[model samples]
Target: MAELSPTAGESNYSQDIQVDEKLVPKKGLSLCSTRYGIALIIHVCNFIAAAQSTVINITMVAMVNTTDHQFQFNGSTEQLPGGPNNAPDSLPAEAPTYDWSPQIQGIIFASAAYGMTLTMALSGYLAGRVGTKRVVGVSLFASSLLIIFSPLAAELGLISLIATRMVQGLVQGSIFGGQNALWERWGPPHERSRLCTIALSGMLLGTFTITLVGGLISQTLGWPFAFYIFGGIGCVYCPFWFILIYDDPVSHPWINVTEKEYIISSLAQQIHNGLLSALPFIIAWVIGILGGYLADFLLTKNVRLVTVRKIATFLGNFPSSALLVALPYLPPSYITTMTFLTLSCGLSPLCQSGIYINALDLAPRYSSFLMGTTRGLANIAALLAPTVSGFLLNQDSEFGWRNVFLLLFAINLSGLIFYLICGDAVVQDWAKGRKLTRL
Candidate 1:
């Protein structure tokens, strides 16, 4: 095997190295070659799934009004004569008719997170056995089914909705895990940073799309139809996934010989080590927890509406108008709460990608494992966020949001410290001091 070595005077090394034509591996589609395209598709899928998740938060009021027997709005038990409220008017309508407890709502919101916490821990093991493509495919398929069933659960009861959400959460976790693994396997070292940015950015897009679409759908066709739309979109993407993706470079026919050589040579140095060594899982945990709380804090505090509006305007007038239309329909308290939540949630993925990309930089071979570990730890944070927030909110509803924000900020600052201290140097000097090393 020919090994690369730095030399003082050698130029045109590519021409000097002679090998049997048969021995030189032919160029083929590799992680480096196909990463951008595959990652793009994965991002699209993630966005659809994420949108479904966030959209429901906005539609909670509409959903309860339409489906639940015990739900009431504005202190009046009187049923609307027509519209989405199909429940019988004769049903006993009393004061405190709908039991919309924060605990119950927390359970509904937290179900997916609980599943994510569990699945992310085990996803690496599962992906090792089934391959990343299968893992992602199966998870997305199951999630699509669960999302389709979510509205049905709403029709049944809050418990049923929670159950479906939990299932969906598990599937979502698996998708995230598998996607990360796939990227590590396929992405080139040079492109890892940009690829991570693009892949993670999808979460924001997904959140925005879901919130905007959910608001529109809930306003027009009612809340259940929102799930249908998201689910349908997910299903449509599955076939494309199946057709376009391959598990490894050897499996892809479209890759060229030069690209394959580049990928193998680039990754050859790092593939033999253990998978989790380079990951900053602890940092990820802190970031995830703080990010979740920050989002909740923003949702509850509403301090950045002007900034948010400017952002929305820069993006487009349609999205800004959509937010305005949706805000009035929501309870005044929730409007600001959800807005901040959206921004915070959107920001978390970027933070996560930044941390995970560092792991790849530190150990390219073990990138998948590091990503999985970090993701698992982060999911735990996601699971705990709602519960902690609930506890604080219960103690003092007025000031609890600020407390959460403060806590999140402190935690994130700590993570930033770790990042500064531990991030890998861009170029590693593996050989130094020895006679051969000096060469």
Candidate 2:
């Protein structure tokens, strides 16, 4: 294999590998240097993360049910579960009572979001300091460990569960951040959009699979088993990732000189420098916040509006309360939830790719910085979503959920305005005006 050249104007210590022109055409390079393997590994990692998220959702319902059926009405010595502090009195007064209320559930769900918010903001800095591969591997391992322990925390008390979930969220945020940086480093320019879409789509597939599998496990083996199974799956991926992935294109033995050149040249033309590069970050932030909120809103309300009435009618056909009892037993609810979740997963990535592509189009060199900044900002919206949703649900008004959706829709509309104003495809002339400056 030929030795790789250092990036122009950057020091040797920077270890930046520039792609040459010969890599563009498949015929010019050997199979070993191609990007297919790298893309596949990244996608696999994404799938695992996506599946993990869905499994948590499924497990939450099962755990709450288990707590309700086994502890509360049994008159056990356990204290009633609280949100952040004291337990609420609204818990159902019956046998097999649960300690925590819906409000508490919302808090647990939001814990991850809070952790994710902080980590995502710092991800770019971390990746720059350490390297994408290390960050990715560490985050994946940490997330898997936290997920495995989450059920044990649940058994301890509500506070434990929240704490564990918050840790998982922090790891998850790093995963997202690291993965984004990895793509920028490894993916080819021509195929970035397609690869991004594929990675994201796999995430949707994983989300759907998790719901299906978690629901089945809950119905048959029990709810705690769902966490065990998903956590195990996450652990399995770690070894595979370590063996298969590399941080940069030239580092891979299989990638050929021709393909590497093609990738480098394709990316070189797209980078922009200076404050002008920040424009895409702002645009993506506005878009992602709206997109994230809309996804949660639709999952919470719109699906029910579209399908719940029919489901209720079908259940009503059965004996009294029989449908209510049977609903959890059936897989349709999980399937419906997964379907909606998948749509959100699918849409958000495509939207994000479009934004990123525009960034590259306008400023190729600054793409990484712009992407990092925008994603960090977008994550702030993610942090607010679950907490805001919890607050609305706590209101106990008839239109609580409705109000949440309304707010989400308004946010999405605001994003649309930004998209129209700032999301132009044409590259701006910011970098051309400045003298050549190397980082």
Candidate 3:
């Protein structure tokens, strides 16, 4: 086997590296390739899932009535619920706004997470038993319908809105596990990193797009439009998913015979040749996409797989932790603070190539179940992080933010250290269906 020199990282020799032909396309890379296309389409599904989930976070700012703030009108300040001076006529006409308390808002923010935590493990198991195409596609369709009606639900009452969101969460909770199930069948072991990360990156892209635009849509067209537009996109994408995706290459109608053989042969070799296989809470798209390519490139150059996972994990965790430590000390400019925060967030996606993909390496058969278990547990943190931060801020605003950053730094640092020490890429015996016999 070819091996890259230890000093190769210090040089540009990677440019001259010859990737194994089994993983590389002899005809040259093209998006039209079947597996790549499937990955890309799954990326869109992730995008929609993320957009629907987080758009509410931004639009809620516009949805709530700012009763405490006074608006300037006719050179005299008047309370909100009245028109502001010289407001654009083209802006959305006044819509009903909620007077939800901070406590209620907190519940709304965490409502989906509650549902997600409850359903995630079950969804994973279900995806494996059923099939990824229907599980994921149906979830997306159901969530989209709920989002479209979210505005109506909110107007009806707080309970109605929460119920709608909770149900939406229940459906979307299936998506991640379903995605892993798809990769189990569709991804060749050699190409696992790039294929999985490419799809996962869509979540980041969707988050960024919704964050950047959700506010504007809420401000101009009204908050309801944000829900409508994002939800509608998910609905429209369903038909394509049902039409194009199959459980595996062997079953796909349009996959060429050569590509089918290549995928199947690659996976079979990995099972016999070696054991086992194979993010962040918020991420950036570019980092993930690039990190996946880098990982696959390193693997192609004969770098040990475990070593590559460690490298990616360190890059993902350490710098972000350090950045969090320094964030509280940055100059108080929002621009500067936001720049640093974005940098920290952008660093997180590197794990896509590391611990994030490790589940598939350990056990292809149970990838979905493992993903669900891990993600569901992590989301407990997601469910509580905001509430915890809010509680801290309520006690003391300045130190609360500082403590939050410090807490994140400590958590990330500890996780990085543990993973660096104990992380493995080897498949476990159980993953290969070895039964433990009683003595």
Model 2: per-residue lDDT, tens digit, 138-172?
88888887777777787777788888888888888
Worst lDDT 10-window in candidate 1: 1-10
- Compare the candidates by lDDT and give the number of the best one: 3
> Model 1 segments beyond 4 Å from truth?
1-33, 66-99, 272-411, 414-439
TM-score of each: 0.53, 0.53, 0.56
TM-score of 3: 0.56
- How do the residues 1-439 of candidate 1 rate in per-residue lDDT, one tens digit apiece? 0111111101112222221222333455333456567668777877776665565565564544332322231233444443333432433232012234433554566567656745664565567556778888888878887877776777677778788888887888787765666654665543444566566656667765665566567666666777788888888888888888777666778866675565555454333211331122222334445544554465477745233222222232222223433432344453364453343333343332234334434433233234334543454444355456556544544444445555665665555555555554232333111121111
- Candidate 2 all-Cα RMSD: 22.6
Ranking under TM-score, best-scoring first? Answer: 3, 1, 2
User: Which TM-score value belongs to model 1?
Assistant: 0.53
**Candidate 2: what lDDT?**
0.52
Against the reference, the lDDT scores of all candidates come to: 0.52, 0.52, 0.67
lDDT sort, best first? 3, 2, 1
